[model samples]
Target: MVRSSAPLRRLGAELRRLREATGRTQADVGEAIGRSHTTLVNWERGKNKLSKSDLVCLLAELRVPADVRKGLELLRAEAGTGTSPWAVYGLPDWLRPLISFEEDATSVTTFQPVIIPGLLQTEDYARASHATAPQLAAPDNIERWVAARMRRQQRPRNDPHFRLHAVISEAALHLYVGGVAVMAEQLRQLVKATETDNITIRVLPSSRGDHAGVANNFTVLHFANPSADPPLGYFDGPLGGHMVSDAGDVAAMVTMFDDLRAAALAESESASLLAAILEEYQ
Candidate 1:
């Protein structure tokens, strides 16, 4: 089955918003366009593509302004083009949606048991980590992967409205990803991130023993408009990664995140741990 993508999701969200502005139910629009509400709902959910003709019909039925229609048309066009800035990195198809969804999400919650979260990794640390992955062992692929990872970091760092909460294992702190100097700087960077209001970093102490997140690392993306763009869960594998969109699956991830948070050190205490680790490296 063809999975829904970030571009399609964004486009669908815009369409949903427009439809809401007109105060029309999906059934009403569907009837006007000679289609079933299920079909319309699928289009609005990004589960199915919206044809050009149908889009035009829907826009006309809604009496959208010419300018608004133009913008929607542009979105529709982009939905099909498969063009994301990070696409140039030659990332696998399964990976691009994770980056794209991250770019559009209002908040992201992540758990890392083995290493630093991608958004928190320093350049050298990222390089070191990528070099160990078989798929990214090539020098060029490592650079590209690092560059994409760095670019993904900008959203959480720079956008106040884009919140990031990371629950990381204490073991990850001692992994020494890039050796002494790189790990030191990476730990220092984590401490620095704690100063930001939008970024929350928590450490799951090793004393916690077995935990809900011990199985794997994962991230959940949430949108400002939940009805249109629902929460999504993503996790990596040996070949690539997969996005989890089922409401139940995403809810389970949320539960797991809450459990991790309950077991993790508070933000301030985590910062202290980070500082202590940084000193050890120094």
Candidate 2:
């Protein structure tokens, strides 16, 4: 298992929170753990990982409960490897940030009016879609990109905090990306994925005309921190991508998402829509 930077960062944050809850200064904690305050600061910043012994000592000094200790250990387990297939093939710089956020998100809500969201795409659908992109069409690169997308499924399955909700436009079901056979498989996968407790798929019918999100596709990522200023928003672009972290921008996008979800079909209705589309292919 390759550890991601996100887990380490989250661990650092939890450690800081624990220290604060205990009303102990970094200097005080460091003294108890036999480390310098600067070293403790670096660990809390996620700039470096604390040794196992050091972590044990710090936890003991901070009076961290068993549950918190278990949580930190889980995060440490996730911090082992950083390189994914996407990183290995040098995916675009802008995409790397999205990948990191995707890895860490507690909940992901997406509105995709144009096509199937990447995380839900089947391998064949992903390949065909990527092959059509002018900048990403290189035969070799398309395979790598598709592989990277498939790897994202690992997060939802393995990470307890991860949850995905995608509201797809009806047009995405109508458009045959790879071919009839490929689309059939893709739809089948979508149905299967929806069965997972952590995933939800909803369809926004075309009949809901001229809605708030007709012109854009965006994803909102919520973290575990309720008091965090705002969730992250990601929008795709013709050339690259855009990330919105500013409070105002993210707030507006989130409002739009709420509206989109309201206008979308209920979960059962969405499943029926998918089934109806699949029947057509059959």
Measured against the true structure, the TM-scores of the candidates, in listed sequence, are 0.76, 0.71
**lDDT to native, each model:** 0.85, 0.81
For each of the candidates, the C-alpha root-mean-square deviation to the true structure, in angstroms, is: 6.8, 7.6
**In model 2, where do residues sit more than 4 Å from their true spots?**
1-86, 228-230
* TM-score, structure 2 vs. true: 0.71
Q: On residues 1-282, what C-alpha lDDT tens digit does candidate 2 reach at each position?
A: 654546666788789989999888999989887899988876775546676778888888888888889878877777774445456765776677688667767899999998899988988998888877756567767777778888887887677568898999999899989899999998998888778888889899999889988889999888776463237789986678877766789889889988888899998889888988888887
Candidate closest to the true structure, highest lDDT: 1
lDDT score of residue 8 within candidate 2 = 63
lDDT of model 1, residue 13: 72
- Residues 139-248, model 1: lDDT tens digits: 77878888888988889878898999999999999997878999989998999999999999999999999998897889999998788678999998667788887799
